[model samples]
Target chain A: MFKNFFPNKILSLSNNLLNSLLVYLILVMFLGLIYSLYISPPDYIQGDSVRIMYVHVPSSFISLACFGIIGIASILNLVFKIKFIPLMSKSLAPVGCTFTLISIVTGSLWGKPTWGTWWAWDARLTSMVILLLFYFGYIFVWKFVSSFNKANKISSIIAIIGLLNLPVIKYSVDWWNTLHQPSSITLTSAPTIHYSMLIPLIIMLAGMIIYLLIIFLMKYKTETIKFKMNKIKNKK
Target chain B: MLGKNAKKRAILLTLLLLLSAVTIFLIFKSLEENIVYFFTPSEIYNKQNISFNKTIRVGGLVKENSISKEQNSVKFIITDFKNEIIVSYSGLIPNLFSEGKGVIAEGELKDKKYFIAEKILAKHDENYMPPEVTKALEKSNK
Candidate 1:
C-alpha cells in the first residue's frame, strides 16, 4: 500500500504538468461549486428544499459521465486492444458505483419529503438503478475473470450493450412525466434555483470531481505496479 | 520502488477522500438546516433537550378525534402504540394525513412533549395504511 504513492509517472510528472493539473482542478472545483450553489435561483415551489438539486444534479451528471468514459474505454480495449484502456474502465467501476449510490441515496432522501415517498419506481430512478446494476455486473465480470484478455473481450461487449441504459436514464425524466423531478440545468430551462444554494453545491461538486480524479490516477498507478509485479513473477 | 508507490497512493487517496468527505459534509450541514427529520411519538419523548424553534418529523399514528384547529394553527395527537404525542401544526398537511392513520410530522418538538409540526407525512403501504400501523393495531388488540 505504501508503494502506491510513488508511481513512476506520478513521480516523473513534470513540474509544469503537475502544477497545471492541480491548478485546473482547483479552478474547476471553485467555479463549478460557486455557479451551482450561489448563482442559481431557488425553485418557485420548493423554496429551500430546491437546494438539494445543486448537489444531487451534479453528482448524477458525474455518475453518467463516468459510465460514458467506461463505455469509451471498453471500446478502445476492444478495437485497439489497449491494455491500459480496459484497466482504466475497470478502475472507474467503483467510483461510478459510489457516485450512483450517492445519487440514489440523496435522491431518495430528498424524495421522501418532496415526492411524498422514500422511493418510487419512477422512470428516472428505475433507469439509474438499472445502470447501477450494469456497473456491478460489468465490474464483477472482470474481477472474476483471471484472463485479462478474455475479460476485456467480454466486458467490451457488455459495456456497449450497457450504454443503452445511459440514454434511458438521461431521458427518462425528459420523456416521461414521472414524479421524479425534471432536470433544472438543461440547456433550455433557466435553472429555477437561487445563488445561495448553487454556490455550495458547485463547490462540493468540484471537490468531488477532484477527489475522483486523484483516486482514479492513484488506482491506475497501483494497477500498473501490480501488472509489473505479475510480469516479473511470471518471468521468475 | 513498490513500497514508495504504494505509500504515495495511500497518502494521495487519504488526502483526496478526506478532502472530499469534509467538503461534502460541510455542504451537507448547511443543506440539513433546510431539511427535517422523522421520529416516532416515543422518540420525541425519549430525546432530551427538545426545542420548539425549528422543524423535524414526528412519526406515528394520528390519535382518533384528536385533530382540532384554531384558524392557522391546527393541533393533533400522534401515537406510536407506546406513547402519544401532542402536535401543533401551523401549515397545510398532505391529503392522506387523517385520524387513525400513520403519519410522520415534520416540525420542532416544543415544551418537552409537544411538537409544533410544519409538515405531515402520511405513511402508506400499497395504497394506504402503512404496515407498521396494522402491526401496532394487532398488538394493541391482542
Candidate 2:
C-alpha cells in the first residue's frame, strides 16, 4: 500500500499529470477571477470592498489546509519511518508559507475598508500570525539542519507541535470576542451568505486548490531530482 | 517487526506532544479574560468591579433611531438587547456606522449607563448578500 507513495513512483506519475493539472488550473482560475470580480454581485453592506473576500478567504483556507497536510504527513513519517514522507512535507512548507503571507496581506487590505483598522490584536488575527510563525520555524529547521535524518526528525517534531495551533485558529472567533466575525459557511449548517456570492467563493476556492497542487508537484519534482543527484554522487 | 528503539521513540514523542498540548491549554485558559476583544453592554453591567478611567471596548448593536449628530460630536446608544450604554464620541466614524448596525466603542466608562468613546469602529455580521437581496429582505420585514 505504501509502495505507491514512493518518491520515484509519485515523480513519474506527477510528471504525466502536471500538464493536465496546469491546463485545468488556468481555466478554473480564469473563470474564478471573472466570476469573483464581475459576475458576483457586490455586497449590500460592504459594497465593492466585499470583493476582497474572493482572494482573502481562499488564501486563508489554503494556508490552513497546507499546514494540515504537512502535519498529517509528518505524523505518518514518524510512525512508519518512510524516507520520502519528509520530502513531501518539505515541499509543502513553502507553499503553505506563501499562502499564509497572502492571507495576512489580503486580510489587512480588506480590514482597512471594512474593520476601520489595519490590524487588531484580536484572537482570530493573532492565531493566524502565530500560524505563520510556526510555518517559518518548520521551514527554518529543514534549512539549518545539516544531516537529512536529523532535519527530518526535528521538522516532524515542529510540524506535530504546530498542528496544535490549527484548532485554536479555527475556533478563535467563536471562543473569544473577536473583531473578526464567526465563519459564515460551516459544514454542519447552511451558509448564511447568498448563493450569488457563495458560488464565486467556491469557484475561487477550487482554483486556489488547483494552484496549490501545481506548486506542490513542481516543488516535489525538484526535490526528488535533487535527491537522485545526491544519491548518485554518494555512490560514486 | 518494529524495532524496540522505534517503539520507545514513539512513546516518548507522544508524551512530549501531550504535555505541550496540556501546557498550551492551561495558558489559554488562564488568559481567557484578557483574550476577549471587547465586552458587551451586559457584561459591563454585570461586572462587580470595573475601573472608570481605564479605557476598554464595548461592542454591540447601535439601537434603532438612537443616533443624534451635532457639530464635531455624536451620540448613540449601544445595546446588546438585554442592556444598553449611551455612548458619546467626537471623531470621524467609519463608513459602516449607522443606526441599528453592529458597532464597537473604545473609550472610558463614565457611569453605569454612559460611556465616553475615543474611537468608534463598525462591526459587520457574517451575513453577506447583494444589495437587491438586502432590499427585498428589508421590504419583507417591513
lDDT of 1 by residue, A1-236 (tens): 34433445544434564466678778877776566556555443343455566567667888999999897766555545555677677777888888898899888877765546777555678778888888888888988989878888788767766765677677665554344545545677665333455456667777778767766765666677777788899899
Off by over 4 Å in 1: A1-44, B1-142
lDDT of 2 by residue, A124-177 (tens): 999999999999999999899978889898899889989999999999989889
Model 1 lDDT at residue B67:
90
What is the C-alpha local distance difference test score of each model? 0.67, 0.90
Q: After superposition, how far is residue B101 of candidate 2 from its true place, in Å?
A: 1.6
Candidate 1 lDDT by residue in tens digits, B40-106 = 6676678777666865666667899999979988888888788888888777676556787667666
TM-score of 2: 0.94
Docking quality band of candidate 1, CAPRI definitions = incorrect
Please give the TM-score of chain B in predicted model 2.
0.90
Return the lDDT, model 2, position B121: 86
- What DockQ does model 2 achieve? 0.74
